[model samples]
Target chain A: MQHFLRKTVAVFESLGDRSLDSFERLGRSTLFLVRVFKSIPFVFLRPWLLIQQLYSVGVLTIVIVLVAGTFVGMVLGLQGYNILVRFNSESSLGTMVGLTLVRELGPVVTALLFAGRAGSALTAELGLMKTTEQFSALEMMAVDPFKRVIAPRFLAGFLSMPMLAAIFSAVGIYGGYYVGVYLLGVDDGAYWAQMQKSVDFHEDFMNGVWKTVVFGFVATWIALFEGYDSVPTSEGIGRATTQSVVNASLAVLGLNFILTALMLETS
Target chain B: MTRQILEIWVGVFVAAGIAALFMLAMKVSNLSTVSTGDTYEITARFDNIGGLSIRSPVKASGVLVGRVSNIKYDKDYSVAVVTMSIQNRFDSFSIDSRASIYTAGLLGEQYIELVPGIEDNYLEDGSDVVMADSALILENLIGRFISEIISK
Candidate 1:
């Protein structure tokens, strides 16, 4: 009885501690976000740094975006074609493929991929910099690390997500087109026309764009924050990088659900 | 230099993103298909709208001439008041024209079909269409058939 009571007490104690830690981290993250935003003006001042970050963060991620987008789109086309043919409504294959990609999969898959690839990289890079006291060195030289290291990377990531999602959607549509038109022998004109007829620019496309923008901001912030808050050790760096990717992915999916619900309700 | 090459690549990537957005807008979305020219509004009341919704195409003689812009329940008439915007170029609707709800294909979306009449007068902006027919409900037809058989 004593041991059981003690164990229950210990569990409650740990739970309380965890909640407290989470609250502290949330407060720190808010402050960090403010600092990052405040330093955004610095990004334009040194345009070259922003470009470099953009290259590393955005350009480097293109290959995965393209490959994943194509495969997703092709699969959608194949599945959509099979499903839509049931009611002799195979002509709606384009609408299904286009809407599914533009409204949901494009931003979602790109964010997940970005979290795995660029998010992890950002965490690791910042973690290593912290591990080597590079941030302190910058401070010693009167350089604000937020401006020099964090904001440009944040801005680049934030900018890249929407663009990458757009590319993903575009490639995905083409992939669907290839499968539906060439492989499945669907009428090309009907496929394109049906998609255009169904998909509203403001409702579907712009909503997706906005979703990516929010996702980009979230993903990059989590990655950068994990690195900034990392304990100064190799194990800590590894842990932070892992946490960054996992947390960013979970945050993105949760935010997508909320955003989708709101968008659907309004539309 | 490698730096210049990187800059060029970044520029290309940005441009590609823009192009992709443009392609999506043009080929995948209804941005281009939506009429931007002058339009005239027509209102009609129906007893039942069925599955009629906003932005549903309004057709004339099997050709699209307008779109249903809004749908609201009228408390006074206890009916669905539907507002449609027709393109100015196709401004040939007579005052005695009939507006009926139609379904596209089988089990597809509903639209409003405008049948022209031989009246000399034309329907102007904010014209209230008096000759409006409500949508056909399949369940009602089956119910009526059952009732007639029971009575017989």
Candidate 2:
């Protein structure tokens, strides 16, 4: 009976502790976010720092976005064509591909890719700097690490996502067009005309823009916060890197559903 | 890599992204535009629009010439009023040009087809298309055909 009572109390205690731990992390991250925002202006003052980080974060990520976008679009075209052919509505291939990319897949997929590629890299880099005491080294010279090291990377990651999403969507549209019109013998003029007739700028495209911006913000925040708060050990750095990717992906998918729901209501 | 090389790469990346956005605005959604600044407005009334909505294409001789800008029910007249904003270059349409609601294909989008009528003057902004033919309802057509056959 005493053993059973101890097990019950331990389970309750474990659950309570984990929840409290997450709450505390949330509060700390909010403070970290505020500090990052405060240092943003300082980051802009030195454009070179931001540019260099942009090279690492944004430029390097483009190739993947483009290649993935093309394949995704081609797949969509093939599937849409096959399904639409059954209904004798193959002319609508353009509308289906264009709307699907602009409304959902473009933003969501690019974000997931960004989380895997840039988010993990950011976390690992910051975690290593912490492990090597680079943060303290900067502080020893009376230089604020947040302004120099953290904020630029955070800004770069935040800025990169939307641009990447646009590139992805555009490339995907081309891929779909190629597959639908060239490979499948669908009429090219009818494809474009049908797409132009259906997809609305205000309703489909702008909503995607907002989704990417929000995703960018969440992805960078999770990445930077995980890195800055990491335990200063090699093993801890690895753990933090994993946590960054996982957290960012979950945050993105969850936020996507909410944003999509809200956008649907507005449109 | 060197900072200069990195800067160049970033510039190229940014340029590509901007280009992609331009393609999306121009070729994807077409930026929700009727494609010109100088436009003229003309309203037409139909008994039943039959799935016609705002932004539906307005065509003449199978060529897209304008877009439907607004649709409202005229309670007093018990009809649907459609406003079209046509590009100014096509201002040569006669004042008596009539519009018919047309379905493009089987289970396809509906649009407004303007049929030109010989007249002395051209249509200007804010003028009405005097004769607006309503859309054909498939169910009503089938019902009428069945009733006629049974009566006969």
Q: Write the per-residue lDDT of candidate 1 for residues A1-267, one digit (tens) a residue.
A: 999999999999999999999999999999999999999998898999999998999999999999999999999999999998897888899999999999999999999999999999999999999999999999999999999999999999999999999999999999999999999988999999999999999999999899999999999999999999999799999999999999999999999999999999887
Candidate 2, residues A1-267, lDDT tens digits: the string is 999999999999999999999999999999999999999999979999999888888998999999999999999999999999999999999999999999899999999999999999999999999999999999999999999999999899888998999999999999999999999998999888888767777778888889999999999999999999999999999999999999999999999999989987755
Instruction: Please report the candidate that would top lDDT against the real structure.
Output: 1
Q: Tell me model 2's lDDT, rounded to 2 decimals.
A: 0.92
TM for candidate 1 is: 0.96
lDDT of each: 0.95, 0.92
Candidate 2 CAPRI category = medium
- Measured against the native two-chain assembly using Cα atoms, what DockQ does each of the candidate structures obtain, in the order listed? 0.87, 0.64
lDDT accuracy of residue B35 in candidate 1: 74
For model 1 the local lDDT of residue B88 reads 99
